[model samples]
Target: MRALTVKGVRIDDTFAEAFGMRATAVIITADSPRWAHQAALTMTGFATSVIGCGCEAGIDSELTAAQTPDRRPGVRVLLFAVSTAELQKQLQARVAQCVLTSPGSACYAGLDGEERLRLGNALRYFGDGWQISKRFGGKHYWRIPVMDGEFVCEATTGLTKEAVGGGNLLIMGRTAQTTLAAAEAAAAAIAKVPNVIMPFPGGIVRSGSKVGSKYKGVPASTNHAFCPTLRGAADTALDPDAACVLEIVIDGLTSQAVAAAMGAGIAALVKLGPRRGAVRISAGNYGGKLGPHQYHLRDLTP
Candidate 1:
């Protein structure tokens, strides 16, 4: 494949290492679009990485009234875990805590019927025997009586094969302000891509971490190599003009989706112009000792 570069920003030849993760797609709906988004943001909060959070999740997209099960505006979110059992626990907890509790909000299976997890079935007991089960369009739904009338939720959601997670991009620039801006632009562009989500806050990670840490109990720690403040004290990879670096980490439904997001992010940064201070685009890896999927940056754009 031809190498990819834009506005003097060189795309690294190395690949982003990712691992297999079980994913569950869920739809959250509320009485108003505002509440729908509120529930989505709440459900996906603190789920940027599986290392510490135990799962990774983000809003896939918003759905129109005609596109939702209840003919209401909604949002689709994808939750990924290391295993099906763990995913089931996370889904049940998120729906119960975030969606079910949101005023006038309800949860439903976003994936088409296939391999399944009994999410609602486990949560039905919250009704304390008052919960009612209904069959709609050949699917089971539970109506849990709550303070605000009822909270409707699907009994099961499909669980697909463990897909790639932890695809990332390192954004380096001449200053903290410019680097943050470039990272934000790249993140905004990636959010528009289908079947993917930037799990981190604003889709940018200022404290990007490595797999292990020097402290015995810590699994991962800040990547000092890319820290501009630690340039003289640590082994740095930053260019001479680079004053700051921010990383965008992506977790997608498929490897292709991840690559597309990375490519789109690079394109967005390219549009910001070379003077925007985005100097180099690189990726995170463990010398190929990590996951199976290796997303090469050059091939993503070329």
Candidate 2:
């Protein structure tokens, strides 16, 4: 196979395998942008992977006062789960614990679809029979009294079963610093794309994992093949000069959105080139057995 180079970075002829997921999006508003972001960060915290976290979530975008339903500063968060039942459970728990607890916070549907997930509907119980149900703009909302004032949340949010998860990029560099820089650039680029979220901390994952572990009962373990320190001792996938590898995993409402985000990230890496960024770019997959969606690196290269 011919080598595929974009700018000075070598693009591996591989694809990112992604599985289908049940996803939902919610808009959280607060008295200020700081509070809104605080709630979002808290809600999305510890939610990096479904294998352990029960869900994968991240802030999709920040919203201005003019963009929110309540005319306040807010953020849009997207969450993905393996099944609708799990998604519903996670969504209700996060919103009830994080958003409702945030001062002056309000939650609304950020997405619209025939299928729906419980939001305020489940949290209304906390109101202790004091929660007020209101119908506004053909949508149902529950106003739950709190210390600051009241937490207003929509009865339900849209759920999309067509969501895609596990889209990723492997950035390998000669040093950890350069590899981190490349991963940051890719993360920033991907953040700008709508309908997608990078659930990892800072949108970069240092501990990339394979399907299973050497120990029994562990569903996943460190990807030793990509570890620079384990080069000769393991079935290494990196070159001799490669010292570090970082991955960016993405989940999107649609396959197109995931592809768009991956393309944007690749373009950002290409702009930085090999000298300041990644020496090589690849993707993780389980030989196409993991999922139905396969985003080819060559096809995504800009």
Candidate 3:
């Protein structure tokens, strides 16, 4: 495996190495893309890792005005969990707590034929248990009358084995501004692709985490290798020339999804990165043993 080097940092050729987990996709629509993304951003906030967030989620794709039921712009988001039971619990909390709370936002099951169900029924109780049920296209929907208006969402959703989290990457850049621009560029490339998500703010995170922790109370701690503050320490591992690092995280539920995401993310960043060799990209993993899937940055670009 090879990595693109910039500012003395390495863009590791190794993949994210994710595993199969149960997944669900949600469709959120609103009066405008602004509102739609508002719902999406809020719903997906703090959902960086499944270990702490219960589920990992991101904006899967954007829907054109013609494709939505409300004839408005929207975003499709996918969430995955390690266990079926955990996924069920997440469905209710994310929908009720995030999607439902966003004003003028309505959620639908992007995965329409889910044999198993969770949210629609449980959240209907939020309508004071007076919610009205509607059926369209042989699919059950719940109309939860709210103070603002009606909240229409799908009842049952499809559940299936998905790659879950098999794709991801980390991009490091010299300046915060440049890093953001490059990360956004990468997100723009991946945004239109199906079955993938950029996920975090600007589709990037400055602080990534490690599997174990030095503190007994904290199950995880910030990734020190990528940390700029600890760069000068003799015991540190970061390359001497590394200035700053920005991380871009990708989510894909399929091998194709993983490939496409890695491809777009790398290609876009390469085109937009700082010209003074100030940017570099890499992947994080405990080793090949840590994750079932592997993504090579070189292969993605090639």
Candidate 4:
């Protein structure tokens, strides 16, 4: 599949073939951004991918104070990987290491369904089998009594099959300020749609990673093709006049949902690109290395 470019847009002829993934989202609430950061950072730390971290997780989005359970600042984090069994193990470990250790931190399932599930319940047992389960507004929740109060979390994750992991688009501009502005605008637009979420801060990643690095003990490295500073890496795509580029990584239950976010996101970006030095917008792919899903920018053109 190929993405389109018009005017200030620069589409790439590539496809993001994502494989089926078993994923989970946990909602963490804290008294303030400080506390929220405390919980969120701890929860998502060391969880860059399932290959090493046993789960690929990131903050899906930031929830405004009013949107949180206790009217506090919080964030929704998405964790995904290859299987439901692995999902359980990874989540169990993550919860034990991150959320369990953070004071005033509470976790809730962002994904739940009629399908059979595990994580939340199995891990709750760590409460020395004294955990209390609560069902509020048709959603089941667990209140694990902690010294700091109670660690509130959703009882189960919404598990699905054939999930898509990477739906990314790059925004190029003349300056970092402009690039950031455009990326932010696009992120806001995509956030309005359901069944999808941007997994990075403000929906932008300044440093893009490639498959491997030459450095010792580095399995993955930065994507030099997209970096303006790495121009001599052979067939790099950097626009010499380009001052900055930002990436947006998206995830969804299905390919269509991801595509929808991409389309809407690109539309919102088109409106800000020119003024903010955003000369082009493009997508990233592994040269058809991913499995079956493809989103074309031409189809998403506004």
For each candidate, what TM-score against the reference? 0.95, 0.99, 0.86, 0.78
Q: Rank the candidates by TM-score, best first.
A: 2, 1, 3, 4
Tell me the deviation in Å of residue 126 in model 1: 1.2
Where in model 3 is the C-alpha error above 4 Å?
Answer: 1-11, 232-237, 273-278
Backbone clashes, candidate 2: 0
Model 4, span 1-302: residue lDDT tens: 34356666666555444556777677787767777767777777776555667766766678888877667788877777788888778778877788777888776666656664555576688788789888878877777888888887777766777577778888888888988888888888888766666666556778777777889889878787887876775667876767788988777767787888888888887766576647777777677655567776667777
In order, candidate lDDTs are: 0.86, 0.95, 0.75, 0.74
Q: Which stretches of candidate 1 lie over 4 Å from their true place?
A: 1-4
Clash totals, every prediction: 0, 0, 4, 11
Indicate whether candidate 1 or candidate 2 has the larger lDDT. 2
As for TM-score, the candidate ahead, 3 or 4, is 3
Model 4 off-target regions past 4 Å?
Answer: 1-7, 29-41, 49-52, 59-76, 101-106, 132-143, 152-154, 212-219
Q: Candidate 4, which ten residues in sequence have the lowest lDDT sum? A: 11-20
> What are the per-residue Cα lDDT tens digits for candidate 3 across 95-199?
888889888988877775536657687788887877999987787788999888998887867776765574666766666666667777777788877887665
lDDT score of model 3? 0.75
Candidate 2's TM-score reads 0.99
Best by TM-score: 2
lDDT of 1 by residue, 1-302 (tens): 23357777766778888887888899999888999999999999989887778789999999988889999999999998899888888888888898889999989998864789887898899999999999967989999999989999999988877567889999988888888888989998999998788888978888988767888988888998988888889998776888888999998888888889998998888788557747788899888886888888877753
Cα RMSD (Å) between model 2 and the true structure? Answer: 0.8
- Backbone-clash count (model 3): 4
Error of 2 at 99 (Å): 0.7
In model 2, how large is the Cα lDDT of residue 177? 96
